[model samples]
Target: MRRLRIIGIGAGNPDHLTLQAVAALNTLDVVFLPDKGSEKGALRALREEICRRHVTRPDIRMVPLAVPKRAEAGNDYRGAVDDWHAALAEAYERLFRDHLAEGETGGLLVWGDPALYDSTLRIVEAVCARGLALDYDVIPGISSVQALAASHRLVLNGIGESVLVTTGRRLAQEGFPQNAGSVVAMLDGEQAFAAIDPAGLEIWWGAYLGAETEILASGPLAEVSEEIRRRRAEARAAHGWIMDTYLLRRSR
Candidate 1:
């Protein structure tokens, strides 16, 4: 059975690839790069750049795999995501068949850490279900959580308060989490912060984080919320797609 190593490259920055991740990148027999066609090819290109910088061997193979577009599930979002993971796992297995022999090392450069809001881990589990005994290893890297904090120079949690990390959908359907002093929101297609009470609330927002064209806006929600939305739309239209995360905190 071949081993799969999922390495985190951080948010679009080549320098964010740590030495440990660089070692793993160099060690892998084949690096599987996911190409979401032109819409999201920037991600794959960034990964390729990392390899070009860190990979010493000219003989090392870089494989570009076509990622499947997810089908919309009307309801049962979890089930829908699970089905998509299953399909992605099958795609991965098929790609490995031609590239990997038993016990070979395979690597995937996952955006951000694989443990946080990432489907790569679930997809790998589905791959293992197909009767392939697998050796799995994950190399954690700087996540968007860290990026948000670094960009804003704010800690995720206050001195003694708990922090809640959630999706935009959850933040919208449900209000700000009870008893949480800080909230980090990601994967929000809609600007969910507008639904929260803006009184005494502060927001740190960044789009295309860690990229050359990164944009950041932060201030009291009442003052910056509309600006973030307007800037975000303009950036998305200019760049085709955008990856962003934000932090919200309510004044004590």
Candidate 2:
């Protein structure tokens, strides 16, 4: 039987590796890292840095998991994603089946917590569903949502009210939740907040969170939205990638 540890290294920062995460890292016999090409090489490098900073174990293997560019999600977004996920499952299955021997432990270091917007757990589940025999444990770490709130010095939920977390597409199509006191929007490539009516809305936006390249903006939505858009675009252009999250609140 093979054992796998899915550990979250948090968003972008090596220091975000919890003591528990470090212990898990030290226990792994092999680690799989996604090589996202040169443009996003910085991401892979960050993961490597986390391993170097922690993981004091001897002779641990680091395997590069070659990731394919996801097909464009045109009209059929879900279909495109399903196709891509299937492709990823195949890749993951190969890594596990070939690299992980019986009774040996393997690790998959996830960004943020495994339960968030990340797809690694889903891909791993898919691999298991394909008849792979393995038991996996998930170790949680700081999420970008937490990082966003901490950086902004704002709580995600209003007093006695719940926070609504959703993607940019849904936020655009469904509008703000009628009762949500706070809303955190992520994976928003289009800067959807700029499309919404900024009246009575406040925003706290952060990009490349938990890293030295982090940029934060907060103010009345109308006033700060353009700056976020400009900054996000410029940062993405400079770094070739950007992961951002923002909180939108119903102004009191």
Candidate 3:
């Protein structure tokens, strides 16, 4: 049987690699790096940097896997995602069969914690469902939410309050989670913050977090929303791609 380790490398920081993640890296026969097109080259470089800094073993092989692009947004968003994941599963199956030997340990370094806003685990499940006999383990690392809060020097929730982790689409469609004291939005390419009423709400936002090119903005939503949007656009234009997260807090 083959073993697969999904290791979280944290948010764009080599230092975010945990001791356990380092150990897992050292034990792997091959490390699968996903290339998300040229626009996200920086992301791939970050993973390579993590391996360079942490994996002491000189002979370990790093394999670059070309990721399939997802379908353009349409009415059936779920169907599009399903088709995308299926294609990824086929690619992953081929990678493991051709590159990874049976009984050997292979690894995939995921950005941030694999459990949050990441589909690696789900893709792994899909691979297994396709009859790939493999054992797997998940090693957690610092998530973007934590990185955002840390960069802003604030807690995710207020005293005895709940926080909701959601997507930009949900934020736009559902307005806000009425019961949530705080809402952390991820995978929000739409700048959904612009759609909400900024009054009485404070926002902490960060882009390229934990990386040297990092950007941070916060304060009353009305005061900083446009500034954040401007900065976000500037950063994206400069870097070709950006990964950002934000926390929205309501006045109690």
User: Which candidate leads the pack in lDDT?
Assistant: 3
Error of 2 at 108 (Å): 0.5
Candidate 1 on 195-242: residue-level lDDT in tens?
Answer: 777888889998877778879999999999899889998998998888
State residue 159's C-alpha deviation in candidate 3, in Å.
0.8
Candidates 1 and 3 compared: the better one by TM-score is: 3
Over 4 Å off, model 1: 37-39
Give the RMSD in angstroms, all C-alphas superposed, for model 1: 1.4
Q: Which 10-residue window of candidate 2 scores lowest in summed lDDT?
A: 35-44
Which residues of candidate 2, in runs, are more than 4 Å off?
37-39
Worst 10 residues of 1 by lDDT: 36-45
lDDT of every model, 2 decimals: 0.86, 0.89, 0.90
How big is the positional error of residue 93 in model 2, measured in Å on the Cα after superposition?
1.0
Model 3 over residues 4-116: C-alpha lDDT tens digits? Answer: 99999999888889999988998999999898854467777878788778888888888889999998969999999999999999999999999899999999988899999
User: What would you estimate as the lDDT of candidate 2?
Assistant: 0.89
Model 1, CA-based lDDT: 0.86
Model 2 clash pairs are none
